[model samples]
Target: MSTHDVKHRLRQLRGLPERVRALEAEVQENRQLNRRIAELTDIVTELLIPLEARDRDKVAEILERYKQGL
Candidate 1:
């Protein structure tokens, strides 16, 4: 009805595009970070593959020795 009201509504509509772009950018960044996390987890899992054992005592002993200055 008024010039000011129309201008305010247009500004709000224009702001929606900027907000959408920001959300899209954040989604892309999250995807990349998730991929990196998976890669690092796999690498660490591979490195520690030999450390997994059915023997609890062996794991405990190793930790104890490490805590008591080797």
Candidate 2:
């Protein structure tokens, strides 16, 4: 390895910290999005319970409750 090669490698590594920080921020955003998706999925599943049971009144009740919660 020559001095010029070592200097080039050092310069390349200089930006690694910023790159890692950007990637970490992206990962955090993705996690939050995934969590929101899971919560919506849960709400959808709950809403489907009444449909599966074929109870219109229960479905209406559940929908009202969900609306109030939101």
Candidate 3:
């Protein structure tokens, strides 16, 4: 085979592992981000209301000052 043909075949066949590694890294990053979102959602949905209500006066005071600044 010609050098040119041999080089072309090698180039086409050599990139599989690198591409697979890149895709696996992205999948892991996405999984971590998804887990964080789930944790935050659970906090907001299941725990935030009573926690806020227990300190309703403080929350209202903070909101009043925040509104005044805005």
Candidate 4:
């Protein structure tokens, strides 16, 4: 309606693309972090079960798998 309002809207629109890209990058980072956390959780659980049963061979296997993942 007003000149000032129109200019302000245009400025906001100009910045929108950069803001969207930033948000997309942040989302990708979060996904990667979540995937890593899940992998770690699985490794811990595998180690715990083998260790509880005193299965050295199984524990070693699990550790090797974790190393390979890294």
> Highest lDDT: which candidate?
2
Residue pairs with backbone atoms closer than 3 Å in model 4 (clashes)? none
lDDT of 3 at 52: 70
Per-model RMSD to reference: 7.0, 2.7, 7.8, 3.7
Top TM-score model: 4
lDDT of each residue in 1-70, candidate 4, tens digit only: 8999999999999999999999999999998998889887886776655567667787788778767866
lDDT of 1 by residue, 1-70 (tens): 7999999999999999999999999999998998899877865564345347646787676556545751
lDDT of 1 at 48: 40
**Which residue ranges in model 1 land beyond 4 Å of their true spot?**
1-6, 48-70
Q: Assess the local accuracy of residue 13 in candidate 4 as a C-alpha lDDT between 0 and 100.
A: 100
**Rank ordering of all candidates by lDDT, starting from the highest:** 2, 4, 3, 1
Better structure of 2 and 4 per TM-score: 4
Q: Given candidate 3, what's the lDDT at residue 41? A: 82
lDDT of each: 0.74, 0.83, 0.76, 0.83
* Per-model TM-score on C-alpha atoms: 0.53, 0.64, 0.52, 0.65
Rank the candidate models, highest TM-score first.
4, 2, 1, 3
Off by over 4 Å in 2: 49-59, 68-70
Clashes in model 3: which pairs? none
> Under the 3 Å rule for N, CA and C atoms, how many clashes does model 3 have?
0
